[model samples]
Target: MNILVAHNYYQQIGGEEQVFLAECNLLESYGHSVYRYILNNDQIETTPPLELLGKTIWNWDVYQEMRSLIRQQNIQIVHFHNTFPLISPSAYYAAKAEGASVVQTFHNYRLLCPNALFLRDGKVCEDCLGKVIPWQGIQHNCYRGSKSASAAVVTMLTTHRLLQTWNRQVNAYIALTDFARDKFIQGGLPVGKVFVKPNFVDPDPGIGEGKGGYALFVGRLSVEKGIDVLLEAWAQLSTKIPLKIVGDGSLASEVNRATQQLRGIEWLGRRPMDEVYKLMQNAQFLIFPSKWYEGLPRTLIESFACGTPVIAANLGAMSSFVTPYETGLHFQLGKADDLVTQVEWAIAHPEQILQMRQNARTEFEIKYTSSESYQQLIKIYEKACIQ
Candidate 1:
């Protein structure tokens, strides 16, 4: 099948971008014809706001370009990764009008919430979850903490929503978790149109022997990531278990302060994927101290594939993946003391930890590898094509 993928990339590099590229490569690796129409937010630096907004609402240029591409290439399916602030929902209509099936991956809650995070004021705020106007998001300045920016997002959503673009244009929606799928359904998307498809790690970084004695934390150092909670827990630990933090973010200074005051804590700034996988292989366990409604964190899969068990906050998708005392242990979200207790327990039970590590790898082999993900993706694509 000839596939045309559309995506609007953020200025900063992150997981979403990685997944988009990985998926493209996976499809191509299977000898499928894949074409990408990608836009980057870095263009905002030179592009005018009004021009960007006009394109975002309905890029006539993208429509014409895509329509011609569809006709020229005889594209059968259109899969969209992200379309925010640019690329627009117009791509869906354009492709559909050109007689191509559309399948979109709900990487974030952009349709329901202006910020696309469903988060505000350092917590999960679903006040605008099912609202067409997302008035609460505008009032709360959800996007970039700016009312103007939030208003723009709300405008985009409301505009497309009233036109019935989401439901009519897109043939299928891929939700990263059942929780996310239900949320989209509540937000007025057709329940039957949405499918749960978790993100997977490609190339199968096979399970490795954990040699590093210290526990590892690999992610952004932000409020929603529960870095503060992780630090507090580390501080309270009676045992001197070394902790290695790999990733940089908004809370770097604060984390630096804690690292200075706390012993047995090492803050390693952002490292390449190869280095990260190596770190995962050597670590005793990965600490996923996230406090948000995360869309299937890729780190968890990477950890599992590396034979490293995780100790994550018991919330959102993490709760679904990290079964307590099985694949990994989970602690109450934002509870430092509980995290400390779980960490200590995990450290003490060496045999159980090893068994959990084995389970973690098995989980990866069964569900999170590229081969498994490819089969699932092909099934979805075939269904979309037939529809």
Candidate 2:
């Protein structure tokens, strides 16, 4: 099949970028022709704010590009990863008008909420979840903590929604978790059109023996990531479990402060993939204490691939991944005390941790392997084609 994939990339390289690339590669590997139509957020620097906003609602250039690609490639399907503030929901119409089946992966809640995080003031804010306009999100300045910027995002959604773009244009929508699927449904997307398809790690990092005694935290350093919560938990833990933090973001200074205050925490800024895998191999378990609803954290699957257990918050996709005593343990969301207790439990039960590590690897092999994901994706594609 000839596939045309569309995405709007963030300035920073992240899990979504990786997923977009990996999916394209997977399709090409399976003897399918894949074409990408991507827009970078870095372009925001050059374009005027009003122009960008207007284009975000409906980029005629993107539509024309998609129409030409469909005719040139004879695209049977067009899969979209992200199209916020640039590529626009109009791309779906472009594909449809060109007689191509459209499938969109809901990596975030951008269509239903302006912030896309559905987060505000360090907690889950669903004030805009089911609203037609999501005016609350605009009022709260939820997108980038700037009302004007967030207003632009809300405007795009409201405009397209009033035009029935989401309801009529897209053929299928993929959500990474059942929780996310349910939320999108509640937010008025057709329930039957939405499907569950968790994100998978490609070129699996072979399982490793946890020989090192340290625990690991690999993600952006931000308040929403619960980095401070992780630090507070580690500070109170009676046992000295060494923590190696990988990745950098807005909370670097706060992470540094925590490192200074805590004895065993090691803040190892951003590292290469191989280095991160090594850290995962050595660590006792991965710590993921995110406060917001994650689309599906790449780190969790990476940890599982390394045969490493995770101690994550009992919220969002993390809760679905870290099934207590099955794959990994779950701590209370945003609670340092709960995290500390879970950490202590893992520390005291080294043998149990090892068993959980084995279970984690087993889970990855059964669910998140590249081969498994490829088959699932092909099935989704075939289903879309039949519809």
Candidate 3:
């Protein structure tokens, strides 16, 4: 199959960027010819605000380029990762115009929320859900705290909704989880067009022995991630279990401060993937305390690949992934006391943790391996072509 993958890269590299690269590599590894059309957020630095807003609605250059690429390559499927504020929905029309099926991966809830996170004021806010125009987002200045910027995104969404671009142009929408698929459906995506496919970890990290006594937390240190809840939970613990945090974000200073005041807390800021994986392999269990509706975090899958049981918040998609006392355990979202209790339980039941470790590895093998993901991708592509 000839595939043209399009993505708009963020200025700061993130899970979506990694997933985009991994999918491209996954396709090429299976002998599929893959071509890429990429736009970076760095371009926003130089682009005038009005021009950026104009391009967000429809970029003629991107449309012309995509048309040419599809025709020249005879692309069977044009898979899109992210197309906000740069590549635009125009690319989807361009692909369909050239007789290529369009498959868009819903990495985040951009179609439903201007911020794409459904997060506002440190909590999950779905004020725009099911609304044809996200007027609430514009009123709240949801995108980058700029009302004008939010208005631009709202305009794009409203324009596309009116044009039936989302409904008609895109053949398939790949959602990362069943929870996300449901949300997209509630937000007005066609039920038949939406499909659930979780992200996979390539070149499997292999199972870990669970030898390390300490627990691990691997993600950004931000409010929505429940970092504050994690800190409070650590403070409440009767038995101080060694905890290593691996990531950097807005709350770096707060995390750094916690390391000094809290016993058995180590802050390893922004390590490379190799180093992070090493930590995952050695840790007794991984902690995911996110408080929002995450689009199936890659970190959780990575932990499973390492055969590490997770102690995650019982909220959103995390609740679906972590089976209680099976693959891992779940704590009450944003409740430090519940988290502490779960931590103590995990500490007391070493044998159960061992069993969970094996189960986590088995889960990874069954659901998250690159081979399984590739097969799923092929089916989605086939579905798009048939549609």
* After superposition, candidate 1 runs with Cα above 4 Å error: none
List, residue by residue over 1-387, the lDDT tens digit for candidate 1: 799888889987788888899999999999999998898988878878778777778888888888999999999999999988778888888898899999999888888888887778777888987777888888889888888777778888889999999988988899988888888999999987888888999877778787678899999888889888988888876256889899999999987888888878889999988999999988889999887888888999999999899999888888888878888999988889898889889888989988888999999988888888889888888777766
What ranges in model 3 sit over 4 Å off? Answer: none
After superposition, candidate 2 runs with Cα above 4 Å error: none
**TM-scores, each model vs. reference:** 0.97, 0.98, 0.98
Candidate 2 structure quality by residue, lDDT tens digits, 1-387: 899988899988899999999999988998999999989999999999889888989999988988998999999999999998788887988998999999999888888888888778888888888787989987888888899888888889888889988888888889999899988999999987888888898887788898898889999998889988988888876257788899899999988887888778789999999999988988888999999889987899999999999999998888787789877899888899988888888888988988998999999889888888888888888777766
Per-residue lDDT of 96 in model 3: 93
Candidate 2 weakest lDDT stretch, 10 residues: 233-242
What is the lDDT of every predicted structure here? 0.87, 0.88, 0.92
Candidate 3 colliding pairs: none
**All candidates in order of lDDT, best leading:** 3, 2, 1
Which clashing pairs does model 2 show? none
